[model samples]
Target: MAELWKSLPSWVRNIVVPVLVLVLAWNIVTFVFGVVGALLAMLVKLLVVVGIAAAVVILVKKAAKS
Candidate 1:
């Protein structure tokens, strides 16, 4: 597993993981917000902004590590 990781270029091993993680995290945030937003607010539109911000933060942090 470690060897396989090493075989890839740095951008793939580093940037790609963070990007995939960010996408997955963003999806999860959206799903959770959808369920709660419907119950809590008249509009669920605000959640998209928050989710994008959270996903960007996650991506930035992960990218910084690399």
Candidate 2:
């Protein structure tokens, strides 16, 4: 595999890599973002819930410490 890749010309590799990356990125932008965006939104909501929980914990801790 390494020898096969090494046999290819540098220009070929350069062109192929950029094209593949562009296609993969375009698909992700067009398709994967929907699922990933939903997951990210859920993550943000979870973080908010965690933040509120932490604040309550901190207030309780401070009250006890005082």
Candidate 3:
């Protein structure tokens, strides 16, 4: 592997390889951010559902007291 890299032209070794590495890193970061965003969205939706359920229970109890 080292021999093959050493044989490559200077422009490819310096520019192309670095650009490819950067692209790979960028793609990985984007994928991680997408996963996190989806998880957060699900959490927000779950909280909203729980809040609605609690509100309904409270209202029912208040009505019973009246």
2 versus 3: better lDDT goes to: 3
lDDT of 2 at 46: 100
Over the stretch 1-66, how does candidate 2's per-residue lDDT look in tens digits? 999989999987889878999999999887877988899999999999999999999999999999
lDDT per residue, candidate 3, 25-60, as tens digits? 999999999999999999999999999999999999
Best by TM-score: 3
What tens digits encode model 1's per-residue C-alpha lDDT throughout 31-50?
Answer: 99998878777455568778
Best by lDDT: 3
C-alpha local distance difference test of each model: 0.89, 0.93, 1.00
Clash-forming residue pairs, model 2: none
Model 2 regions more than 4 Å off: 1-31
What TM-score does candidate 1 reach? 0.48
Give the 10-residue window scoring lowest on summed lDDT in candidate 3: 5-14
Error of 1 at 48 (Å): 27
Worst 10 residues of 2 by lDDT: 28-37
